[model samples]
Target chain A: MTSLSTDAIPHAQSYRGLVARRLAILVGLAAVLVLSVAVDVSLGPARYALGDVLRTIVAPGAADLQMRVVIWDIRMPMALLAVTVGASLSLAGAQMQTILANPLASPFTLGLSAAASFGAALAMVLGVAIFPAAVGLMVPINAFAMAMAASLLIFGLSTLRGVTVETIVLLGIALVFSFNAALALLQYFASDQALSAVVFWTMGSLTKATWGKVAITAAILALCTPLFARRAWALTAIRLGEARAAAMGVPVRRLRLEALVLVSVLAAVPVSFVGTIGFIGIVGPHVARLLLGEDQRFFLPGAMLSGAVILSATSVLSKALLPGAVLPIGIITALVGVPFFAALILTKGRKAW
Target chain B: MVSLALEQVGARYGRREILSDATCAPVAGGGLTALVGANAAGKSTLFRRIAGQLRGPGIVRLEGAAPHDLRYMPQDTGMSAALTVYESVILALKQGGGGWRLSAAELAAVDDVLHRFGLADLAQRQLPELSGGQRQSVSIAQTLVSQPKVVLMDEPTSALDLFRQYEILEALRRYAEETGAVVILALHDLNQVMRACATTLALAEGRIIAAGPTLEVLTPEMISRLYGIDSRVERCSRGCPMMIVDGPSGQARAG
Candidate 1:
């Protein structure tokens, strides 16, 4: 008979240490986010001192009126939007990877972004909108609707075939190609001015960041975080494969459907508001998985924070690169993300889950 | 004592009948029972039906334990490459109602199971890094850590070396005896069944042809009929029965 021994005490202690280390990483990510927000807010056409920016943030009415407007009305919303979009995309990507059990799967890889772009193109070029009236609002609404449509299509196909990970991923790839072709067709027949609008929208920007968009994205993220957290253990179980997870008493089909819907919401909202910011969805989760292993309790939040940090930092870089011309946030993300992704692949990606 | 009873258990996959009218004598807890059959004899389908994974017409009644107390391990271990052996075992415990965090006692119990399976040294290693036999052992450790009342395993020793297979079977037999759990395994090794299992279930063409004590049910005629091979049943030096196959019989030899 095996006896209860003190040997397990060290394991408990190490487990606690792992939790503490993950928390520290989270704190460090939060610090990066705060610093990026500060830097992004301070740099622009009219440079505001960091002290003045801080002062205006502390008490909005006390600072100079123009300075307050610049910090609060303009830059603050954009920076906060960066955080929201980043966190949402990252968390959604992490969920997708776990549920699909493929390390390479993400919202972008699965064609959600491409489908959203098609919807936005349709709204901008043809005036075909999901939400009529209010010209500026139609793009986000149409984009969100199309993204959800793509997710549903994938989900429906997988259900017909018993919801295997390979089926979902294969169908997602097919959706990506189909949507991209549709997007190309739209661009080919558009007027020059409309074509340029469609092109700029596809490039992705934070220039349209406003309080309304921020509020909507933040609300979606806030509402979905707890739902995802409640299913954290089940999501972790899914990494063991669907059959194994089902045998472990997890309702595999229901969990997969719920997680797919949540990921669509998480991905669609941000893409609607800010166009398609690509790499944060894939890279954020990889970074988090590298730092904190596959424990969903920490990995989920770590992914969100990592995405937030990457996007917020990119937001700062987008403006700081040139004096008055802001680089496209999507372009900057790709440029930065490509090298980092390559380096990760060469270094830690082989062994990473 | 607890027992498991199945009445008229049948299964099919898209009109291909895998099992039909397969009934078992009530197997009491605290012993190893072996389900032995040929390649296409529906051993896995029957096991899945018992594990509640496959839905079919059946009445699987447990005398003293709830259905939730039964755990099934399929032929494929399905261990996640991302999770270490210890984390996977803990995940299994937590999934089985151990709550959000593992208590000290739970951790110790997991450690004891790992040690029993000779997996304590590889506890921190990822599942993909281990050899097949080691991975299978870890999977068994994951199942046993939950301390279920009924354990069903499909080809649990399929990947292990001969000595390791013997070791794992011995540990499982001891575990069943100590906890009074009903342990059922789908096995191919006739020698293992003869040595380790208290009861033997012989199946052919989706039906149970014979079921009783291992020595009594596994006769020379049953072996020849089940496998289409002429075989001699003899007693080993230790007085346990063993089967030695002579050759293919009748139509098989003509072909």
Candidate 2:
């Protein structure tokens, strides 16, 4: 009996250790995000010292006119926008993967990106905006509207069919292919200038980052974070299986609908601002799972921080890659993400999910 | 003692009725009851209705506990491959406790369950890394760790070897006796049902064929009527009733 009691001690201690380790990883990811933001703000055409950037940020009006404008007007919004979009897309991806019960599922996998692109293409090619807004804002509004439309379509269909994961996935895939084909048709008939504009919109750059865009994305994130956090336990239970989650009193259909609406908002807002920044939504959650397993309490925040870190790092690298011009943020993400994703599959892919 | 009473329970899938007006004796606490039936006999459908997974016409009432206190374990053993055994048990406890953090007592209960199920060594192992039998054991441990007032298991011993099956059934019987929880198992094996259960509810084509003590209701004629087989219920040298299937019934063979 004494030996048996001794055997049980390590199990409890190990669980505590697991919790500590997850916390440490979350803290470490937050630090990486902060560091990446610092690097992103410092590196540009006119370089600013890290100390100066920190000082300027701390006391915005105290810095010299040039320094303040560079830090506050130009670089700060871009860095903040990267963090917001990254975290939003990643959290959405994490919830999507769980609710769908598919590791490959992401914010874009359900045709949100395709729908957003189609809407943007319509604005650029046919000069048709959903609302009569300024040219700078009209495309994004249309794109966001179209993405939500796709979400509503999918949600309505799944509801009619009883809201199973299989139904959602199959219907989402059908939408993806249909939207992609429509996008192709639009690009085929466009004039040279319109076609170029459409192509650029799909390339997904951070060059369009502004304080207004940053605020919008940040506001959306703020509103959605608490909602997601409240459902974190139910999301964790969902990782077991939908039936099991329902058995545990999770109200599975309602949970899926709530998650779907949130994911649509998360994916749409970012795609509207930054274009189609792919791979982070899918890869960020996988990286978090590799680090912290499937406990949603940690997994959700871990995915958000991992995404913020990756996108901020990529934003810095995109500027550095070209001497005077910024490389497209989407290209850098894929270049970096694909290799890392491939390596993850080779090493831990078989058992990680 | 707590008890579960079902009255005129009926279930259907689409337009086809699976269970029609099925009723059973009030299963009292501190006793292990076996629900035995052949294939497509609505055994699982009935269990689902009791588990609240299916919306059927019935009044499933508990004598002394709330509806939330009843726990059901499905036969599929839907364990998450990503969660370790310890984490899975913790998730179960959190679900039962309805809290974010586990108290010291709750954590100790999880550890005790893991140790009792011989899963202490594999507590840190991912669930998918274990064999089917090991996963089943972990599933059972997860159910028990919740400390439910009533426990329902569907084919809980289907994946176990003979010794492990006996061990698991014995452990469940002991737990029911100690906690006075109404324990019900949907089983197919006659000998296992007779040995492990004090009461038996035999189902046939969605109707109750017999409901009484295991030894009394599980006679040769009842077995034949339920399963279309020629069988005998006799006492073994250890004085436990055993089932011996002689052959198929004449009508069954002709059909």
Candidate 3:
């Protein structure tokens, strides 16, 4: 009896300590993300010193006109885009993994990226705009439209009475194949210039990022994060399995549908703006899971920060590796993400998946 | 007293009825009740019907408690999450309500259950790292952490070892007595039901055959009808009730 009483205080204290530790890890990831973004802004074809970059970012009017324009206009947009897009995609993937109960479920693996690619290809190759009014922004608009269509398809099918999580994931894979085949068909009949445009879009780059794109992505992230935060406990409970979660009064079907819609929007916006950046969705969540476990209060922010740090750091590597020439950001993400993710998986004793 | 009464509750899958007319007396709280049946006898289906996971034909009335005041623990305890034992129990306790932060009382409740289930030592261990029996114990803690007015468990101890099973049942009985909760367990072992549960509800082919005191409801004839087995209920040297199965029933073999 005495032992039970004595143990209570320490157990409560230890759980609090665990929460503190997870918070510290989240802070650490955010710090790394900020540093990497700074480095990403500093390095380019026309490189500036780190101090000048920091100073210019802090006080834009103090820097010279050329430095200000170059940092703010060119490099800063790409860096900020990396953070927002990375955060958005990673958050999408984390929730997808949660709702689907599949470790491999992500924006890239489950056909959102493929659908975006096909949508962009249609706009580029055939000069066909799915939404006729957006002439100036046909590619992104069409891409978003198609990605939303595919996600809604999954979401619609999942709401049926007997469709399981595995069925949803399988349906996602089927969508991946269907979209990829259509993309291939579009490529076959494309003009040379249009073909190159489609190919470049599929490779995924941040070079053409604009401030407007960054704001939109960040706004979407802001909107979605709070919605997810409100259901943090429910999302965490879901990882235990569907029946168990439902038994806990979680309204499992409705929650899964809600998460799917939000995730679709989260994934669609970024892929539309920045093309198909693949590995961030899959790797970011895994990294956060490895560090912080699956508590959504911590896992949600942790995934966003880890993704931002990874993509920001990848942006730095893309600029630094080929000095005057920036490599395709997609290529570098897979190259850097696979080995780093493999190492984490191989080394970690805890089962992340 | 908290009580759960099912009146003509019926549940079915597509084109096939699983449970029909499962009526039970108003079982008041503060003790263990066993729901026993053979495979495909609709034990889990009945629990689901009562838990509101499935839409059935009849009424499940609860007295002195709302629907949310009941928790059902399904048999399958397969967990692959990266959360620790402490966090998983915390997850269950914080299921429907509460904010991001854990209250001191909430933490204390979780700790109390963990200590009761002998899981305080494995508090920091990850879910995927624990053994099968340990995972079952963790699931029990998850079910009871909320201290619900009515608790339904479907084969909760199937994965537990002998000693662990006894210890968990003892903890559960204490919980029901202390909290005045209606605790119903779907168990395959008739002997364990005889030892731990005061009341037993026997089902055969999706129909409630008998419901009353465990000893009266678990007669050799009832066991034969439910499980197609010839069994005898005997007292051990320590005066504890045990079931001694003779063989498959002659009627079952002929049919």
Candidate 4:
């Protein structure tokens, strides 16, 4: 199939044009990202300058040991960690829209985030996290399994022989309530420290960002990114109704199966690590739409970057915006994202939307 | 050979049988064959079966080539609000491949069709921005680009204005004549039936009440029985027929 060589591209020029546009957005975002990292690293501890932040990163020994450790070991990983989680949540949001055919859907709204959080909660709160003498993939294995199960149940309920957007939303709402109820039950049984851990986990923070988790998240994201971009078409096609998609030779069920699995897998990883970060999934794509226009190709890339940009900025702003202390990353994301999307709603209203 | 034929096709969802012993055969030459019936008369059920998106009790044979050569555009013509008109058609073209990518020439051909249907200006607009009529138009346009041997459409004009309705039906007619591709449309409007259709299939309660030449199959009795309303079909000038629904005033012509 790869041999088909993408019959869509007329020549390298058109292909290059799309690639150039995508790369331009990526590059611009990357530069801003680097700047955000510097700003974030310089905020606390030794308060390195922008120049020192760079020197501390690359020139290492040029800076004192303490500044280097703070910059390299702490802030830099947090920034990268924030971007990865942000990308995953937004992409999951986009996929949720496609699968359910509802504009208002997000993994959090649909309960995937809460469900994964519950999985992680079960491990920590209940001490049911099985780390074995034998081979085991640990929390991620359980989280992904539970997340997939949660999503499949939602998919099954929303879908009869035929599905409507309203049905999916209602099912998602039901799942969210029930899943949160289950979390409450788990919380009720937890020890005080475990409960505090679960509660703080749901608020989402970059504080837990570690080198190991960043590597795993990046590797998984890099592998899945192409498929995520390509999914825009399938998503649009599926909205036409899975039956019609099948008639159009889309292998509708196969596509849905793979997408559901992929989105669930994607959702589980980040939410397991970052907990239920809100609005990134909902607002990232909307921001992408406003900036790059609504073409899914543009929308997907736009969403990915808008997500990274917002989270990167939030990572910096969370530390600096407050007088003396850091805020949870999710709090800043929602505060910024809510008002931006609110303005979008007010200006457009439901009809314009 | 029939372009699309269903034999003894019976369909049901849960406990309710929507269609039973329904058989449909379109002329091998290919043009619009309008399926007319009142709401819930098994028109949609038959359409789904013909599209092969839904399986029923019959073997659907495709003539002049592969059985998989037909496509169906459902009533909703499901569209992602996020995609562009250009992206929508490209995906339809890519039906055979896991990815739907249209080459420049292919895209140009699709753009031409979109242009003909007055969708050219909105090619880059998001699907969410389109009106119901425009969305339906884009859906119909996407179906044609695959160059399928047969295209099945449900409620093709149920959402459009009079002018857009005529525009869409006329476009379908032109495409059919140009490519000899059969078009099956389940229609709510019978005037469109006489105007654009060469054949008519009237179905009710899972049975094909009548199916044949458009003029003969769509008698006043046939329509009244299908719709459960008092109506009449008559021969009109210009070698075209028309429907007159009986009302309190007198005999009224239904355009």
Off by over 4 Å in 2: A1-8, A133-136, A350-352, B235-237, B253-255
User: Candidate 4: where is the Cα deviation over 4 Å?
Assistant: A1-27, A61-63, A116-172, A179-198, A240-247, A251-253, A348-353, B24-26, B77-80, B98-102, B228-239, B247-255
List clashing residue pairs in candidate 4.
A240-B78, B19-B206
DockQ of every candidate: 0.41, 0.46, 0.60, 0.35
Give Cα distance to truth, residue A108, candidate 3, Å.
1.9
Question: What lDDT tens digits, residue by residue, belong to model 3 across residues A39-151?
Answer: 88989998678899899999999999999999999999999999999999999999999988988989776789999999999999998999899878999999999999999
Off by over 4 Å in 3: A1-8, B253-255
Top candidate on TM-score is 3
lDDT of each: 0.84, 0.85, 0.90, 0.72
Candidate ordering by lDDT (highest first): 3, 2, 1, 4
- TM-score of the B chain in model 2? 0.94
For this target, which candidate reaches the highest lDDT against the unseen true structure? 3
Superposed by TM-score, candidate 1 places the C-alpha of residue B224 at a distance from the truth, in angstroms, of: 2.0
Model 1 chain A lDDT-worst window of ten: A1-10
Per-residue alpha-carbon lDDT of model 2 for B51-112, expressed as tens digits? 88888897887888788888888788756547788988888777754555656666788898
Candidate 1 DockQ score? Answer: 0.41
Error of 1 at A36 (Å): 2.8
